[model samples]
Target: MRRSRLTVVGNAVALPLLLAVLWWVASADSESIYFPSLQKILGAFPETWLDDGWGSSIIVDGVPSVARLAIGFASAALIAVALGTAIGLHPRLRAFVEPILELVRAIPGPVLVPVVSLFAGIGDGMKVAVITLGALWPILLNTIDGVRGVDPVMTETARSYHLSRPRRLIALVLPAASPQIFAGMRQGLSVGIILMVISEMFAATNGLGFSVVQFQRNFALPEMWTGIIVLGTLGLLASLVLQFAETRVLRWYTGLRAADHES
Candidate 1:
């Protein structure tokens, strides 16, 4: 168990450690104007983000972007799960809307930036709207698939027990479909982050995206690198959080899978 725990820790840090070493070696003696040394970037981190204390530029710039991501993602997940459930339960509805969904999904999310900006203007509302529309498809489709994939036997059992509609959905359907729903949510989050950054790049005043662009245009290479690093860190942290949540929520599933494997 101790060895296994150590192995897990080693595996978790191995890639990051290697990348850090590589970055340090590659850029240690670099003189290029566009590509600052990793040390310089690290040095610039405090100056750019923490110079003004806790409520510094980083917090000011990052919070809105995070908030937008959270709100947009939450809205997408809720709407997608609800709508997907409805469509999954109704074959006619799924048949009627599947083609339309495919057509819309084919249009890349970033492409909607200009179109959404026109109607919503360059505001937080527009940013959130863009994120929502962009991220909605994955969750919606995944939820639909998840719901449809639920065991017919389990569903029939619920019906046989004369479970009320709400009780059946709550006690049986949602739990069965949760894994898929989470999978969709995970995909949506990555897409949402991308869209959030893209939305801010076009007409936004403040965000990590704006900061990165601003730094690049101003030739602040270290600050640009910092923003890029921060974005990567955010993505990593968000994914880890989602994974932790998934493990907790799907504990029973995990146990069942383990038992099956053991058997």
Candidate 2:
């Protein structure tokens, strides 16, 4: 197990290092205005992003982007889980709700940003709404599936023992469904990040996405690249956070699976 863990870690580190080296070597002598060398891009990263100090550009730009993502992602997760649980408990409600879900799902998320902007306007609210709406579907569907997929035997046993609804939920349903719920949340995080940028790109005065677009229009290619790198880094960090949370939350599930595998 230790060896396997080490191998996973080593592979993760090695692939990125190899890719970075390849990028560095391949772009070392490139003179294209659109595609600057990796060295130039790296050189520009500090001044481009950090500017006068650590907080200058990041304060104006990065904070809002990250904030929007967090708020939107959290809002979506909570709402989805709650609604999903309710719907999963009622077959009639699910039948009605699913048609609406399918209709909305057919429309792409980016299109909703402009429509949402019309009502919410081009403010933080609008951006957050866009992110929330975009990230909502995956989580909602998965939570519903997870809740409904709880073992019938387990549920029947709980009912036979006269377990209250809340007790059953607390002791059984959520635990059984958590793996799927977490999977949905992971996907939702990615969607939220994408929508964060897309919403800002569409209409915003200050944000990482807006800043990157501004850099592009002004031909600040290196700065644009730096903005992208920052976005990628944020994504990596967010994923790591989710992974840690999942590992802790589902430690019992992991142990059970491991023991079964060993048997």
Candidate whose TM-score is highest: 2
Instruction: List, residue by residue over 171-248, the lDDT tens digit for candidate 2.
Output: 998889899999999998998998899899986898988988988888989888888888888887788778768877
Clash total of candidate 2: 0
lDDT string for model 1 (16-90, tens) is 779988999999999998898999989889988778432337678888989999999889888999999999889
Residue 107 in candidate 1 has what lDDT? 97
Give the Å error, residue 46, model 1: 0.6
lDDT of each: 0.87, 0.87
Q: What clash count goes with each model?
A: 0, 0
Candidate 1: stretches off by over 4 Å = 1-14, 52-56
> Which 10 consecutive residues of model 1 have the lowest summed lDDT?
50-59
Return the TM-score for each candidate structure: 0.93, 0.93
Candidate 1 at residue 76, lDDT? 89
